[model samples]
Target: MILDALFFLVMAGLNLFFWAIIIAAVLSLLTGFGILDTRNRVVWTIGDFFYRVTEPALRPVRDRLPNLGGIDLSPLVVLLLIQAAMLLVAAIQGYLIRGGVYF
Candidate 1:
């Protein structure tokens, strides 16, 4: 029971992070399009917040990927990785529930 709850918690956290990456990407787009006024304090604050939250995860991926001139694919890669992690968690939970023993 506890293991199931723990797995759920981890999955939820990963799910939240996945959405954060998407939101960060959308916010960047809006700002780039001049739809979001980053000059405004509120907009800047929100943008900064998302940037601080998502950038750490994105930085390494960005470093490894070749530059694509005004195009960023790190967020998409991170989202896919998050999905894979969630799938791995689910698989572990299923294995435990099926009486698989740890070696």
Candidate 2:
């Protein structure tokens, strides 16, 4: 039962991170296109919030990947990593369940 709960919590966390990455990506584009103004304190605050939440996860990916001029693929890679983590957790849970281990 504890393992199951832990798995669920992990999945939830990964989902949240996945959504955060997506939101940050869109916001970045909007800001770059001038659709979203970062000059306003409110806008800046909001943008900073997203950046703080995502940068830690994204920084390593960004550094390792080649710079593609104005294009950034780190978020896509992060999303893929998030999905992979969720799948790996689910697979472990499945294996434990099949083995008749404690839930």
| lDDT values, one for every candidate | 0.92, 0.92
Q: Give candidate 2's error at residue 101 in angstroms.
A: 0.5
Model 1, runs deviating above 4 Å: 100-103
**Cα deviation of 33 in candidate 1 (Å)?**
1.0
Considering only N, C-alpha and C atoms within 3 Å, which residue pairs clash in candidate 1? none
Q: Which stretches of candidate 2 lie over 4 Å from their true place?
A: none
- Could you say which candidate leads in TM-score? 2
At residue 3, what lDDT does model 2 achieve?
Answer: 83
How well does candidate 2 match the true structure in TM-score terms?
Answer: 0.94
